[model samples]
Target chain A: TQLLEQSPQFLSIQEGENLTVYCNSSSVFSSLQWYRQEPGEGPVLLVTVVTGGEVKKLKRLTFQFGDARKDSSLHITAAQPGDTGLYLCAGPFNFGNEKLTFGTGTRLTIIP
Target chain B: GAGVSQTPSNKVTEKGKYVELRCDPISGHTALYWYRQSLGQGPEFLIYFQGTGAADDSGLPNDRFFAVRPEGSVSTLKIQRTERGDSAVYLCASSLSLAGATQYFGPGTRLTVL
Candidate 1:
């Protein structure tokens, strides 16, 4: 089984602070996706990075995929309370299949 | 368009009992998937269906876990002899088709086994 390890399992920071979370895996994936999940709700898709070394930004949130396709990162600039949630990285081992292997996850709490 | 929808937002059942969770995919999505999320962990894939047939069931933990998508739009996940370890949030996702397609998720059903 392919495994994705996320560092800093939990983070609590004051609002407006910048933070970055990493997702690493020994196995390479065809693509990677970032999702944010709130309490009592399913995960909401944030971004999908299909190319290695690709960088995408959504407002103050920036996502980067490693050149090797085995890792990725999410950086939040000037975090807000609305950003407090569980951040997850997921991908399928094969491009033809839809089953995703998810990362352990990073729980971020922004104190407003 | 309406996103995926699940029924029985919360379920509390005794150990060794049976339970069923239902999911209604988007209006025309043909691919439905089931996943289980535990405390402090990300959602784990459980099953995947393409059309009315199960394309993959490798992620299912055991034979007790079974899922079916009879009509290709709505699906159900059934658990037999549920164990305490089965307590978790069951998530359902749907996509227009497989092959790296984007999936939309439903608010999951929280199942608690006592």
Candidate 2:
């Protein structure tokens, strides 16, 4: 089974703080995506990184794909209360299948 | 619908009972997916449907779980003899195609098996 492990399962920081979350896997993936989910809601896609060593920024959120395509990172700059939520990383396998494997997740709480 | 829609935002049922969760994918989306998320964890893929056929169902934990997309637009997930472990949020998502396409997710149905 392919497993994606995420670090810092729970994070709590004051507003305006900067934090980073990491997702790592031993198996290579064809593409990776980042999502943010609020309480009692499905996750919303933030960004998708398909190429190795690729970086994409969305407002205060920056996502980076590892050079090997086996890992990814999400960094939030000057975080606010709105940034508080559960973050998840997902990737599809290389066999042309539609199934996606998701990481455990990171719950972030930004206190104002 | 504007996006994927799931019925019964929250369902509470007793153990050994049967439950069905419904999902309505976006119009023209050919690929639909089902996932389960336990508290404090990310969503785990349960099944994938390409049109009316199940392309992949390896993620299903047991035979008690079954899903069908009869018309390719709406899908249903049925769980028989529900167990406490079946308590979680069942999410449905759809994409134009699964090949490198972003999936649009529904609000999900929270099923609590007591």
Candidate 3:
């Protein structure tokens, strides 16, 4: 089974602090996606990284894909209370199947 | 709707009762997906539909769960003889196409099987 294990299952940090969440897997994926979900709401896509060693930034958030495509990371700079939410990483089984295997998830809380 | 929409934001039913969750995808979107999310966990894929046909249903846990998208725009998920373990949020998502496209998610339907 292709499983994505996320580290630091829960995080609580003060505003302006920096934090990083990791997603690792034993199986290689063709692409990786990050999502943020609020309480009582479905997850919303944050970013998708396809190439190995590629990095993408969205405002204060930075995402990186490992060289082997078996892992990924999300780093938040100067975190704010608004950045608190559950972060998940997902990737497809291969090129043909559209189904996604999701990470265990990281619950982040930015205390103001 | 501008984005995916789900009905009956919350449902509470006794165990052994049947339940149905609905999902309306964005207009012109041909791919629809269903996922189940339990407390403190990420959403798990349950089914995926490409148009009116289910391209993949391998993620479904058991035969008691079934879904259909007859017209290719809306879909319904039915659970038979529901158990307490079925309590969770059922999420719906849609994309313009199945390949290499971003998915937009609905608010989700929270089902509590008592």
Candidate 4:
């Protein structure tokens, strides 16, 4: 099975601080998706990056897919207390795979 | 329903008992999926259903776990002779179609096996 590993398993920072989380995988994926999950809720999709060297921005959050399609990253600027949640990265190992391989996940806490 | 919905938000059962968890997908969605999430871990794929048939069930840990979707909409996951290790949150998701469609997940059913 394809494995996606996320670094900085746990993170805590003050409000307004900036942080970046990384997801790395040995196997390449056709597309990658980033999700943020709040406590007691299922993960909500934040963005999906489909092309190599692709970058998409959502307000204060920026998502980037590596040129080789084997890695991805999420950068949050001026983080707010509302940003506290678990972040997950998921994708299919191949183009038509129906199941997604999820990363270990990063739990971020933004303190006020 | 507005999105995927799971029944019995929480379940508590003892070992060797039979348990059933239900999931209701969005209207007209052809693809549904089941995943299990242990404490502090990401969700693990369990099964996928395309309409009323199970397209793939490779992720099921063992024979004790079984799922069925009879009407092309509602799906149920059944666990027979459950073990203590079966405790976890069971999540259900649905997508318009397989390939690259976005999946929307339910709040999940937290199962506790004693």
Give the top-scoring candidate (DockQ).
1
Whole-model Cα lDDT per candidate? 0.95, 0.93, 0.94, 0.94
Where does model 3 exceed 4 Å of error?
Answer: none
Encode model 1's per-residue lDDT on A1-112: one tens digit a residue: 6899998899999999999999999999999999999999999999999999999999999999999999999999999999999999999988887899899999999999
What are the per-residue Cα lDDT tens digits for candidate 1 across B1-114? 788899999999999999999999998889899999999999999999999999999999999999998878889999999999999999999998847889899999999999
List interface RMSDs for the candidates, in order.
0.7, 1.2, 1.0, 0.8
Residue-by-residue lDDT tens digits, candidate 2, B1-114: 598899999999999999999999999999999999999999999999999999899889999999999998999999999999999999999998746788889999999999
**Judged by lDDT relative to the true structure, which candidate is superior, 1 or 2?**
1
Q: Model 1 misses residue A61 by how many Å?
A: 0.6
Point out the higher-scoring one by lDDT: 1 or 4: 1
Q: In each prediction, how many residue pairs overlap at the backbone (N, C-alpha, C within less than 3 A)?
A: 0, 0, 0, 0
Residues A19-81, candidate 3: write the lDDT tens digits. 999999999999999999999788899999999999999999999999999999999999999
List the pairs of residues colliding in candidate 4: none
Any residue pairs clashing in model 3, and if so which?
none
* lDDT by residue for model 2 (A1-112), tens: 7899998999999999999999999999888989999997889999989899999999999999999999999999999999999999998877466687899999999999
**Model 2: CA > 4 A from native:** none
The A-chain TM-scores of all the candidates are 0.98, 0.97, 0.98, 0.97
Q: What DockQ would you assign to candidate 1?
A: 0.91
Q: Per-prediction DockQ scores?
A: 0.91, 0.80, 0.82, 0.85
Candidate 4 error regions (>4 Å): none
Q: List the candidate 1 regions with Cα displacement exceeding 4 Å.
A: none
DockQ score of the complex predicted as candidate 2: 0.80
Candidate 1 or 2, higher DockQ?
1
DockQ of 4: 0.85
- Order the numbered candidates by DockQ, best leading: 1, 4, 3, 2
